[model samples]
Target: MNLAAAHPGFLSPTGVEIVFVLVGVVTLAAAVITVTTRKLVHAALWLVVALGGIAVEYLLLTAEFIAWVQVLIYVGSVVVLLLFGLMLTRAPIGDSPDADSGNRPVALAVALASAATLVTVVVDAFRTYWIDLDASVQGSTAVTGESLFRHWVLPFEALSVLLLAALVGAIVLSRKDGPRAAGPGPVRDPDATGPAAPAAPDQPDTDTGPGSGTDAEGRR
Candidate 1:
């Protein structure tokens, strides 16, 4: 028997599949705009869109818990943090001239290579795997909680620590020292045992007047 005949559902596309594909396209476009935009704030906003799109995709996949987590952590916290950091650091809100660096070509090449490698690896790994929507939910809160705590606890804790470090670093970098207060007079040491030094007397002024210079020359 042919493969399509053996698996009719695989050959036919469902409404969920269509929506998933559409959301994925939008998410990819938003991500591209996020990286390519000249305005830093706009890039951050686009990132919000991309991250929100991912949350929607998770919802469509019936992973409601994961979707909410994505929204809460990434969309709400991470994006807000990024915007705050940008504003705190006084980053250019308008179009930036130096947004594109001289090494962009090299960066682009590396990004493309990494993306290709990741795509290839993922496709190869999941070529035969398929989720059955009709079956029991796989991404429920209990299941996710168990998996996370049992298998992925270390990485999760590490990510939390990393985020905390980034927060602290941003605060440190953005903090500005206040100017020192000006004093009215010179500061003196209070521990000195000797008598206080007396102030110097003002010097008297001497003028070599014309008649005085002539009298002095005659005397010489």
Candidate 2:
């Protein structure tokens, strides 16, 4: 007997499935726009939409913990940091001519090839696999915590380190590349390498004596 025919409820599409499909489509569209948009700020905003859609999908899958984590970590923190970097770097807010280049065809071909490879791999891996609703595997808080700490702890820590490094790098790269402007003090010459030479003291005029003026000009 066919499993799908035996389980009629599983075969039937529900309102949840329809909503999921709609959200997935929106997510895909947002992701495409995020990558293709010429305006950096608009691309960042579109990325928020795409990330939010993924969080919603997680919620639909009954993984509330993961969904909230996604929202907090990716949508909230990461994107905000990205925007902060953009602002600090004084990036252009409007359409940028350099955003798109003449190698668009080559990039598109590479993207399509990567996507096709991913799809083929996934199809081959999960073609006949089905998840059981009653299985012990779950996305509960305790289970997620255990799975993360017990199995994926090192990778998680590494990712945190990576993010920290990226943040530091952004700040470093955005900083002005010269000495800070002098405040209310003497302006030091930036090109001077050694200690400043002592300014020559003013010398009193030896030729302007009391009698020297009379000799040069008797009329005076």
Q: What TM-score goes with each of the models?
A: 0.64, 0.64
TM-score of 1: 0.64
The digit string of per-residue lDDT tens for model 2 on 5-96 reads 45435456667777889999999999999989999998999999999999999877878789999999999988997886676445788888
Question: Whose lDDT is greatest here?
Answer: 1
Alpha carbon deviation, residue 52, candidate 2 (Å): 0.9
All-Cα superposition RMSD per candidate: 19.8, 17.7
Error of 1 at 118 (Å): 3.5
Considering only N, C-alpha and C atoms within 3 Å, which residue pairs clash in candidate 1?
none
- lDDT per residue as tens, model 1, 19-114: 999999999999999989999999999999999999999988989899999999999898997886686445877899898899999999999999
